[model samples]
Each structure stands twice: as structure tokens, then as C-alpha cells.
Target: MVRLRVLFASCWCFVAAASFSQGDTSLIRAAVLEQWVRALSHDSMQGRMSGSSGAQKAALWIATAFRQIKLKPLSPKKSMILPATVETGRLRVRINNVVGVIPGTDPSAPAVYFTAHYDHVGVGSAFSESFPKFAPFHKKTDKDSIFNGANDNASGIAGLLSLARYFFSAPRLPNTLVFAAFDGEEFDNLGSSAYVGQQEPGKVKLVLNLEMLGRARMDSSLGHFPIVTYSRDDKWVIDSLNKYYRIAFGDTSRTKYFLPDPYPERQLYERSDNYIFALEGIPANGIMMTNDQDLYYHHPADEWQTLDYGLMELVLRRIALTVYQWLKASGGS
Candidate 1:
């Protein structure tokens, strides 16, 4: 782990220096990010619980973003919503995954995916009803309860929308780029599981799932860096990222904003959409900034105001740079 951190640090230095000289001026706007997060995390969205009206609304909003970006739908249909039925115990619920694509110059090239789960645990069920663990922190109130999940995933979805816009503006790409906003992730990872199972064989090159990117971990003094978690054998993912950073910045070193997952024991790598793809032997990974012990995690307090828009803007810009260059290096137009 120490060795990997050192490698990443050295590469980041190279990329940073190169970026300054190369004039990579495209930056993620703070207002754009804040708007998306606020819309998704608003009270009317009802925590965006899968199968609920609010979730459907959120899915439609994402589809609108894709349409505005001019991303082609993955299927023959013009619509971006892929609906599925998820079973929980004896109950059945409908969910949707908003999927879009940018066809690559090379038809046979393995596609790269950018994914983020758009669902969250809903409101009303509190300590006395479902989650006893939350009883100590939350107080019973006359007001209605809702878990807005601004950081838990709204921020990730915001990032996905901005990335779609960023890549759509590019002239050419190497390989096909698939953007998936998954639903029902909070309920046993059903959305991503179904999507992965239905894909054509050998079509996936890599999966980069985004989650909880709004706030930095309070435990770290340098808090804003993201944790990039990949499977044990998927070191090539890092190498490819480094390759892109070098190509974009005209530098020989890797990028610095990512660090290996620090709390592997938490099993965070297997806890998101990328895990399903990784299970199928694809080079899958997730980038996020979440700590289970975070005071606001899953609580009603995880609202838009609690988010750090400045940090989100910086992170989104870094992600856009890396992804755009990665596509070029991997054969994207």
C-alpha cells in the first residue's frame, strides 16, 4: 500500500506540472455541479428511493441531461431508461437505469463505462421502525423525515452528468463510452447486476463507478483526495490512467488525485456498481470519498448545504481531464 501511494504521488507531480504548461483550461463550474446536486437532493425528490415516484423523476432528469448533451441511447429506442423489476424478500419493485452511449471510432474496441448509483435509502423509516442503529443520533420530531443523500450519491450523479457533457464536446474518441446511472443500488445492487449480466461478452474494457464525492474524509488532513479502489489484479487500470495523464499533460508521470482504497477491510470495493463488473473479470473500479463513520452519512442532515462545492468542482475537473485523455489513449476519437 505504501509503495502504491508513493508511485501515485510521483505520477501526480508530473501531471500537475504538465497541466500548468499545457494550458488545460477546461474546468468544472461550481454552479453547474451545485445545481445538479441541489435538484437531485431536494426534498421533492423524496430521497430518490428506487421504485418510488421520486426515483422515476430523478431518472427522467438524468435522461434529460443526456439528451441535452446529445449522447446516443444504447438501444434502438430514443429513450434512456432501462426498467427492471427488483425483488426484496416477498416484495417486488420497479426500477430504472438511465443509460447512454457515445459510439467510438472503432466498433470492436472494448467500451469504457462511467457509472454511478442514483438511488438512496428513503425517508420515514427511522430508528424506531427499521434502522435501530440510527436511533442514538436522530431525534423524533413532528416534521417529516427524509434522507436527501446529497453526498451519498447525488454528487456522483452530478459528476456523471458533467462528464457526459465534457466528452460530448470532444471531436473524436478511441472506444465506445457508456454512461450508466443505476437505480436500486441500495437494495442489493440489482440495477448494476442486471446491466452487467445483459452486456455482450468481452465488450467491457473498464468500469469507473462514482459515489459519495461531495465531502472529503474528515480523518485525513489532506481531505479532498479521492479513493480509487480496483481489484487486486487490475493494476493496468492505474497504468492506463497514468498513460492518459501523461498524454494530456505531455508529462511522463502518473496522476496524483487518486489513492488506493485505505479501508479495504470495509469491503467498499464490493459495495458499489463496479463490483458486479469486476466479478466478471473486467478491470472495474470505483472512485469515492466516503467514511462509514461520517456523522452525516445517510442522515437527514446530508443536505445540499453540507456539501463542499469547491472541492466538488476541483474533483470533477480532474476526473474530466483523466477520462477525456483516457479515451484518447484507449482508442477513442
Candidate 2:
């Protein structure tokens, strides 16, 4: 009996050590976040507006990141491009959703998907000259000028890429993983709508959408938490996550964050690409830092310099770890 007790004690110690190591792995440094944000928000990308050359360049960058991570292509053509189109009032333009997949350990296992819209509000309307408040940032009296949506979404794209890198390097994923950088999300979520329309909706078990994570800030009351929004049907999923994860925000137990408030529902959930998937009855949601009340939202002031890189890193790491744990617990394969 004494020998058996000693054996059990040793095993317990090993388990404790392993748990510590796993927590430690959740660290994402500010340096990495800075590099990614800089690249995506660079002026050369011309703000990554939909139907623009900059948007296409951003897509290429995303595809390259997938290749570097060694994720397999999901398309039958073994390519990252999922052909799509967008209608901009009078003009219809063709775009592609950059897609890649990490095959499941068990071929029959259900799939978990990750998505981020790589498009943003392009230059403002020509009426900007009449409304000084709506004037373009980089220039004066310019119509259809660049919005350079650095924090609006470039940050989210970086989070997706970082998460992809983590999963690929660890090579520990059990369930099939699908990573998509969608186009035309800025124009009424057309990209995600297209994706959901094309796929067998029932096959997707969960979706983690990244949006505006770069500018995460600690609210006076909430501490350092990232804003995580989900469909009403995903209450169980959110509860499970809140139970396991340590987030930047304080008092996460407060129902105000997850439940309906006096605020408009569409203002909170309807603006993102995840809404499209959720509408299709898939468990889909998005992570972002903006309270939707941030002063810099969609403004020229929303530049890389204004972002909190350290906080953003923490937010991204938490998201990646949450995804890892979810996949593990769900028997991802």
C-alpha cells in the first residue's frame, strides 16, 4: 500500500508540472504582434479595401502565411483561393476567399473553422467635402480616399495568421481545422455569406472569427478582456469558455457582456462575418477589442501606433489556447 501511494504521488506531481507547462505555452509576445500589425497595416497595402489591389495583396500575404505553416489546401483544386464576387451598388467585382485546411486525425471527424474578414470600409463618399467631420484623413477635398483600416480589421487578420502558425507548429491538432481569410466582409458580409452558401452547413461544428483584436484596451471596470461576441444559441459555448479561460476583462461573470442590453443587437453582432454563419445555424462567433464605443473606431486615427500591442498579444494567445482546448476536449478528430 505504501508503494502504491508513492506511485500515485509521483504521477500527481507530473500532472501538475504538465499543467504549468501548458499555461506557459499561452504566452504571445508583443514583438511578434508588432511585426504582424505593421506588415498588414502598411501603406503599401493601400488599406486593404474590398475590390482594390491592396485587398488582393493582403490575400496573397494570408495565403503565404498558410503555406509557411504547412496547412493543406481544402479546395479540390488544391489552392487557397475560393472564387467569389461582390456587388458595389453599380459595379460587380470578383474576389476570392483565401482558404486552407488542416486535415483531421480521423477522416470522419467533424471540422472546426476559423475566419477573419480581410476587407474594410474603403475611402469615404464624395460628399466628404460638404461634411468636414467626414473629410478624408490623408488628404483634403478627396473623394473615395483610403480608409486604411488598420485597427478595424488588419489586427484580426494578424490574429488568424498567428493562430494558424501556433497550430501548425505544435502539430497537435486532432480535429480537422479550416482557416479562411474572407473577402468583402466590409460590404455587407458578402464573403462569409458566399462561403456559408457554398458549404454543407451541418458539417461545421464551431467557428472562431477574429475581428479588431489589435486595439484591445482594458475598460475601467472590465480590466484587460477582449470583447467576445457570439450568437444567442452559443450561450453554452461561451459559458464553457469563460469557465476555462483567464481574460483581460474583469467580472466576466456579469451577464451584461453576453446577454442583450439596452444597446442595439445589430450594432453588436450583425456587423461581423460570423453573423452569416450563425444565421445558417452554425455555432459561430467573433473576438474583438472594440467595445463598438471606442472613439477611434473606423476613423483615420485608428492607426498601428495607437494599438496596444502587449494587450493584443495576450488576447490572441488566450484565443489560440481556448481554441486548442476546445479542439482537444471535443475530440477534434
Candidate 3:
């Protein structure tokens, strides 16, 4: 018995050492999230509404971050700038989508795409204006003020940047990785729609759309998870994600599920940028904390202070690792 125990201990020690050795590359951390949210959600960005100066500034910042991370531009000459115009009544506003690419070592490998929208609801009626009876104390000062949108989407953009930085700095990836910061997601997903129109569906293997990952609530009930989500016709993706969620989070209760359906808040899956890619038959999915019922959503109170940075970092790291695993399994370029 003593000899057997000794042998088991030795094997355990070897396994632990191997796991440690695999940690040579650092995982996505909270500090990176902090830096990204701070910059993207700064008041100077002015809510980053599509076709607004704030959105343009945010685009420039995202492009700069991609450059700093050494990601090659997928567009011609390593850069792509797509211009779009939206007519809002008497106003005709123009917006642009920023795209970059990291070439994979395997020329024949498929491409994995990561996307996030940087736009949000611009300054508008205060929460109280819509709900005078339930107005909070801070509503008076925050009404009609710039919505910093720290959590609404800046968090997702931060995750996108962190993922890009990781892949750019790490050894050559097997599949081509495309990073896109979409504009006009809040309005009608115009940016992503335009992108889908230009590219062939066969080139994209997966689209991981990040959205509203800043806020963290205490609810662990899978029932609280977002409903009325959308994906491509591929059952493989749904099965894979369902398995991973059950194993990683340990929740196996299957709740009622369906494709995008019109709701009070509109069918969110069809409303966001991911819908554009999904329409093209790409296996696309979105990550978000809001269940479409958060009171602070799109409100001025949606500031950085309300975000759970720790949870945000965890989600981001998990997403990054999951993407890596999926690419490896899918034979991505």
C-alpha cells in the first residue's frame, strides 16, 4: 500500500508540473480590462453614437490599438476603411467600420472572427423622463447627459482588444484571425451588414460577437440567461457551447430556447451586429451580461462604477481560451 501511494503521488506531481509549464503565456488579466474600459468609456468619447464625432474618435482609438498590437490590416494595403451613411429624418450621417487581420501560419486553415460594436445610444431623454414615477435621485443630474456606455459595449470592445493583443503577441496562430470593431450596432447593425455583403460566407468559420459584458449580477440560475438568442443553422455550435457551459459553469438545467423573436426590447439577436453574420450561415454567437431587463441599461448611470471588473476579466479570459480551443479543434488557420 505504501509503495502504491508513493507512485500515485509522483504521477500527480508530474501532471501539476506539466500544467504549470503550459502557463508560460499569461492569461488575460483585470489590469488589461481596466486600461481598456477607462480609455473607451472616458467622457470625452461622448457616447460613441453612430455617425457622431464620438464614434469616429472611438474608431480611431480602436485602430490605434490594433496597430500597437501589430495586427496586420485585412483590407488592402493592410487597412480597410468602409464608409456608410444613415439618413435620420433631415440628417444624413456617415460612419465607418474598422477591420484588421492576423494571418494564420496554416494557409489553408479557416478564419475565426471576433467582433464588437462601439456605438451606443447617444444623449437623449433621461431615465426619469421615460419613467417619472420611478426616478432615482441621480436621474435629475444625469438626464439628457452623455451616456458614457461603460458597460453597454465598451467592455466587449476591451475584450476584443485584449484577444487581439494576445494573438498578435503569441506564436503564429493556425487559422486567420479577423478583428472587427463595428459601428452603428445600436441603430441597425449597418456596419456588420455591409461587411457581410462584401465577404463570402465560406471564408469565415466562426464569429464570436462580444456585447455588454461589464455588468455582473449574483444570479446563477440558467433561467436568468438571455433568451431569444440567434445562431446559424449549424447544430454543432449549439451542441458544443451547451456542453462547454454545462462543464465550465456546472449548470445542466435545460431551459426553453428559440431563435430570435420580437419582444418588448426588440429581438436582440437579430438587432445586434452578429445577426448580419448569422444571416450568411456563419456559426456566430454573442456574449453579454444584460438579459434585456436591466434597469440601468443604456442609461447615464451605466458608468464604470457599476461594472464588476473581476467578473468581466473572468469572462474575457474564458472567452479567449475558448476561442483558442475552438480554433485548434476546428483546424483554423
Candidate 4:
């Protein structure tokens, strides 16, 4: 553990970046994404099950990163830790959501959120129902019990932190940026369910939840170009962003850079924390790169080592740039 902390400290140096002049994506470089994902999905984290020691550790780590990035806490407790309860039928467990704010000059500024749940199916037996839909892929004969969840959500959390850091360094926009590392997203969106009922109902402009972006999309023919989930009304948003992305990045390929959710039958959008916010009648959506096509979706093999850090870096940069552009334009066409 001591050695792990030491390595993490060294990796964190790249986080601050020796120079901020390069670009917005500098802090979110592939190496930095690897470091964040590695630390979050390390065996030492014990799969980050909600209410477990690992989850607590992860929460503290996120709050620390937010603090280091100078993001203000949303809580009056003078901390970034926001508490919630996860209800599992008969049992209730207390968990926490780590939230931070990059305030706009106006107190009335609409809030734009970047979120990802940080919990997984913890240490479970080979037969554990951690992933029921994909249970057929489980290797019951295998001895691995830890559900590292590298892509299931460690990647999302890494993306979350990276965006927070990027916005912290960028010039202020019309909206306040809120980065939330939610807990208990597994076990049926327990954390998100509790959070959507906050003080102000409609103060939200958009919630871009990052989930499972460390790999290529196996569910769609659209390839691995990053994608978002939204209903029919918001399809134009994706198309508009695609046009902007090509012109802004000089992407000549006709391949669409953004696509809508591919697995409506599997309820991919509802499975993520973003859905609960949408239930409250807010403009909330999620960005993801893979679905059930991921062979290791919930398997023990879903470790940090299996992830493509390069792909993840691209995912982060594209989504960060798009979201930032949206914020700057004040949710325009």
C-alpha cells in the first residue's frame, strides 16, 4: 500500500502539468487517464463497493482531486462529501457522493454537471449477480472474486475528474460547472435517485454523465466515435455537435463523430445515473463508448490493464471540448 501511494503521488505530478499553455486536454493526457484509472481500479480498492472501505477511499480521493483543482465544495460542511442512502429492498446502506463546483461569477448561473457513479459490485463470488444481464460471460470455474470495474465505471470517474480539472483551468462560462462522483450507481441507480431531488428542481442546464468509455463500442456499427444517449427531441444536439466537431478539429472523415444510444432494448441510458436526473424533467444525458458488446463488461478481467488509455484520452478530449463549447454557447443550436 505504501508503494502504491508513492507511485500515485508521482503520477499525480503530471496532473498539475508543468505547463498549462499546451491546451485544455493537457491535464487529461492519456498517461494521466491511465494513472487515474489504474489507481481507481487497483486491486487494493477492493472493487469500490458502496459503503465499503474502498468506496470511502475512492470518495476521499475524488474530493482531494477536486480540491487540488480548486473546485469549491457544494456542501456547507466545507467539504466535497455529500451523503446519501442506498436502498436495497430490505437493507439500507449509507454512501456518499463527492461533488464540487467551479462557480460562475453569478450566483444565479445555471449549473452544468459532469457525473459518473463510482461504485461497482465489489468482491463477489463467481456466481455473484453483479452482472445479471451478462451473466452468461461469467467464468464460474475462475477463482477471481474482485470486480475491478475498470471500464464499467473507473473510466467514467477518471473522465469526470479530468473534465473537472480542465474546466478549472479554462476561462469561466455562463454556467457553473458541477462535477459529481456518485456512489451506488450499481444496485439500481440508488445514488442518483437520491440526488435528483435536490433543492432547486430546474436549475440544471445539462448533465453529461460519463460511463464505460475506456473501450470501443461493440453495440453499434458507428465504430468507436464517442456517443451520447438522448430521446428523439435531442437528436438534433448530437447532429449539431457532429458538425461542430468536424469543423473545429479538421476531421475530414465522413464518419459521424457522435451517435445516439444504440441499445434501447437493453436500456443502456436508464442503466446509468444520468437517467434519474432526466426523470426529474431536466436535460440530462450520458456519454459512453461501449455496451454489452464488451466481453469483459462485468467480469474480473475488466481490470485497468485491459483498458485502452489512448482511446480513453481521445474520448475525454472530444467530450470535454464539446461540453465546454455547449456551455460557452449557452445551450445554443
Candidate 5:
């Protein structure tokens, strides 16, 4: 194990020297990212289906990480997890949204949010489709269905937590920052919908949602730059991203990729948690490694082992840096 660690570090050094003259590859920890993804995606969480005991457990784990990172809870109750009820079809269940806040030095400043959902479709039922035959990774008569959502959103959770920890311990920014782990997103973005419904329009300056930050498409290599979709009217968000990204990395050759939803007619913008904020006239955007076309999406086959730690680290570090620069440029001291 020691030798492997040494070899890994050496390889990273070689790669860094070869490619990133201006990038800071050491800003984020690969081991920490790996640990979060592994624990969240473990079968013990039972796919982290919304409103299930498994989802509750996952919420607890996220709250613990927030506390350990020293982020103050945003709720008036002094709690990190906010409870909610979600109804899909005829089924209704209670769930949680884990929230942490860093009130800016200037409390009057606009707030910026970072969000990710930690829920997935639950296991198959007795009358549901055939087990392993239908799902390809399940058993013939498996009593408990495990749709361990590794890439679907576990990777997003890891990114959220890591960013919280990174910013909490660093120099204070000017604008307030909120980190949220939403529940019941799979059930029509219920978690985020509730959050946006309660907030006053324009109370938030920006919303940066992270989802499926794990794997790329089968034809693409791991960490192949993911998509960053923004609100139609929010050109400032994209401009800030590209501007600060260049400022932070000193790499003008590769601009931060931000695009409007190419298929607005498809309502693709409304598909994720960010949509709720967008509907409320708040400038919102999100990061996604892949869309619904990915083969492992929502499949039991999505596991921690399938992700590339090197890519995860790089992408997450870039996100942290880019966000920092954006907030700083927005007047975060």
C-alpha cells in the first residue's frame, strides 16, 4: 500500500509537469474525495432512496461532515438537516435536506449556494421487473433491491462536502455561501422545489448545483470536461466563471465551459435541482458529468470502483477555485 501511494504521487507529479503549467493540482485531496464517494455509495445505504431509512442515514452522514468542517447550520433550529415530505404518484414519504451556511462577513451581502441531491430510485419490488436479468446487476430473487447511486449523485455529494470544507477553512469570502444536500430530487426535484419556494426572489445571487460528477460517457475518458448549463438570462454567471477561471489558473488556452440549455424545448433545464431556483428568477447553474444517455445512470452497475479518482480530484479542485474567484470578483473579500 505504501509503495502504491508513492507510485501514485509520482505519477501525478509527472502528469502535472506535463500538462498543467498554471493549474493547482494539489488544492484538493484525492483520498478525501474517494472516501466520501465510497461511503455514500456503499450498499449499506441501500441506494439512498428518498424518504427511506437509507436516505435518512445518508443525510446524517452529510450533516456530520458539515459539522466536522465547522459550517454553521442554516436552519433556525440550529440543525443541519431540514425535514420535508415528498409525494410522487400516490406514494408519500418524509425526507431531509442537509444544509450548512457561512454567513459572509457582511450579512447584507447576497448569498451564493452550492447544491447536490443525494437520493436515488429505491430497490425493485416483488412484482417489479426480473432481478439480475432485467437490471443486469441484480439477483434473480434478491429480496432487497440496491440501486447504490455512486455516479448519479454520490459523486456530487462528495463535491459538495469537499467544497464546504475547503471554503470554511480558507480565507473568508465577501458573499455568503450555502452548501445544501437535497433529498427527493429524483421525485421531481421536490427537495429543491421546497427550498426555492420558501426563498424570496433575488435573495440568492447564484446557485451552483452539482450532479453526477463521477463518470463520463463510455466513449469519453474519465473527467472529460462535464457540462455547465446556466439560466438563459444569467450571462453574468458564465462570464464570471470564465473570467475568474482564467484568473485563478492563468490558463487562457482552456476557457471554463458554460453553455445555455441547447434544447430548451426539451425542458432539459427543468430536469435537475437548479431548475427550481431558475423558475424563481434566480440565476442558477449546475455541473453534470453526463446526462440521461449514460449507460450507468440510475443503474445498479454504477459503483465507486468505476470512477476515476484522478479526474474527480481535478474537476473538484477546478470547481473550488473557479467558485472562489467568482465570489471574490463579486466582492467577496
Candidate 6:
């Protein structure tokens, strides 16, 4: 196992030494992101199936990482792990959704959330091809039983951890920042549903769900760009809410690129954890890097090596910079 104490302390020191700078998000490190994804998506984690041993292992690691990050726990009983049970008519099994918070200056203000799922379709499960295109080269991959969900959602977890590392050390905001890694997203996105049921919906200031951020291809030749999924009305609300950042994400150009739901026909906005939060009137959206048409999407080929770590770093830094700018403009920084 990687040394969490030493590594996290080094990370903390790296942040502590630097003065907080608005619009300066050099804090995001590709190495750190790589480490996170490598650990979470390692084959031994066994695809992190909900309520499975692999899922439990991943949860424990995330919870420990949260503790190392010094985040306040939301659950009093279970600490950072949001204790919940899934009842499948005949079988009810326990699952943990990891939640940690960076408290803000004002305790009463609505909270901002960073969310992603830590579950995926495990091995031995037959999955019909939605749109299958086998990766041109198997190269060195084991293409066997293990469904290592590296890009499916492990990338999201990596991004969330990077965000936590950045925002935790930055200047304090007026509202709390909650980082939540949910369970059972592959099971019809039910984990977030349970979480949403537990929280007061109106108290959520905003929800930014990170999903599939590792391998991004505008096309085969082109580099990475970001896309966020949100309902039409909620889109406006989110854009208005993040107006302070001057990101101009809604109004895109050739250079400043951000896609507005490329797969509207797929109803992607209603798919991930953000949908559950949005249903409760929370201003929520998911920041995804892919168009979801790729060989390694849910396939066994979706290993850690397939991800574009450099592009992932770039996208995450952009997000951090925007959030920093927003926090500065909001008068809490």
C-alpha cells in the first residue's frame, strides 16, 4: 500500500507553503491524479461492484483518504462513510458512500458538493454492446475477466480527489464544500438516490458531478475538451450561479471549448448522480470529458493505461481555476 501519511503530509505542505492565488490553479498535479486512479482502478479492486468486497475495499480507501485530507465527516455514526443499505426484494446488503466536507466560514449557508460514483459493472456479468468498437490494439492488456472500470468512474474519483486537494488548501469560502463518492451507480444509479433522500435538497447550493474524465477525444485526432450535462432550465440556473467565474462555459468558441450535451437524444443529463440532485431542485451538473463513443467505455479494455493523464490534468486545473475565481468573486476568499 502507498504511504498515505507521508504522501498526504507532503501534499499538505506543498499547499501550505504556497499563498492562495485566485485564477491560479497550479495546485492540480497529474502525478497525484495518476496515483489516485491507479490505486482505485487496480485489478485487485475487482471493478468495485456495489456491496461487494471490492466495493468495500475501495470505500475504506476513500474514507481513509478523506481522513488524510482532513475533511469533516457528515455521518456521525459511521464517520466519513455514509451508511446505507440496498434492498433487492429478497436480499438487503450494506454499502458505503464516502462523504467528507471542507467547512466554510459561514455554517448556515447552503453547501456546494463535488460528487462521483465509485461503482461499476463487475466481472461475470453479461453486457450487450450498446455500441461496440473493439480497441484497435489490445497491446498489453489482460482483456480477460476483470472489468477494471478505470475510465468509467475511477477517473471521476481521481478528479474529485484532486479537487479536494486543491480546494481544501485554498482560501475558505462562504459555503461548505462536500466531496461525495457514491456507490452503486452502475446499478441504475441508485446510490446517489439514497444519498439525496438523506439530505435536505433545498440546502444544496450546487452539485458538480465528475464522470469519465480520463480519456477525452473530441475526435480521434483532436485533443480534450469538457462537456457538462444538465437539464435546460437547470442549465441556465447553473450558468447563472457560476457567473462569477467568468468561465463563459455556456458561450463557447473555437478556442474556449465546452460542449452543451452532445448526446441530448441519450438523455445523459438525467442519467448520473447529478440527476438525483437536480430532481430535488439542486443546481447540479456533471462535468464529463468524453462523448461516450469509444472502444474502452465499459469494456475490459478500459484499463488505467488508456486514460490521457496529461489532458486529465489540464481539464482538472481549468476547473480548479474557475472554482478559485468564483470563490474569490463571491467575497469569501
Best TM-score goes to which candidate?
Answer: 4
Clash-forming residue pairs, model 1: 11-254, 12-256, 172-333, 173-332, 173-333, 174-331, 174-332, 174-333, 175-332
Per-residue CA lDDT of model 6 for 206-246, tens digit only, reads 78889998876565343535445455456664454345334
- Report lDDT (Cα) of residue 23, candidate 3: 29
lDDT by residue for model 2 (117-221), tens = 887655555223322433443353144355667777888777777777666654455568888899987667888888777765457778878878766545566
Mark the regions of model 2 whose C-alpha exceeds 4 Å error after superposition: 1-27, 124-145, 246-266
TM-score of each: 0.83, 0.80, 0.77, 0.84, 0.82, 0.82
| Candidate 3 C-alpha lDDT tens digits along 216-327 | 4544654343323345365566566555544433456764222233343456666688778888777787756665567667677778777777777666655555455556
Alpha-carbon local distance difference test for all models: 0.77, 0.69, 0.69, 0.77, 0.75, 0.74
Residue 276 lDDT in candidate 1: 83
Candidates 3 and 4 compared: the better one by TM-score is 4
Q: Candidate 5's residue-wise lDDT over 1-333, tens digit each?
A: 999999999999998675443234354677888899999999989888787788999999999988887889874665888887766566676879898997788777888899999987656541123122234444432553677888879999998988887787556777789998999887789888776655443467889898887775432432346455645677677777777777877876664454455556756567889888888787888777666667777677778888877777877887787787677767743
Which is better, 3 or 5, measured by TM-score? 5
What stretches of model 1 exceed 4 Å from their correct place? 1-27, 126-144, 217-227, 250-255
Q: What is the lDDT of residue 44 in candidate 1?
A: 91
RMSD (Å) per prediction: 9.0, 5.7, 6.2, 8.6, 7.5, 8.1
Q: Which scores greater on TM-score, model 2 or model 5?
A: 5
lDDT of 1 by residue, 147-177 (tens): 7889989999998887777776665566788
Candidate 3 Cα misplacement greater than 4 A, ranges? 1-27, 76-81, 86-91, 125-144, 199-202, 221-232, 242-266
Q: What is the TM-score of candidate 2?
A: 0.80
lDDT of candidate 5 at residue 306, scale 0 to 100: 84
Indicate the residue-level lDDT of 157 in model 2.
Answer: 77
Question: Which is the winner by TM-score between candidate 1 and candidate 2?
Answer: 1
TM-score of 5: 0.82
RMSD score of candidate 5 (Å):
7.5
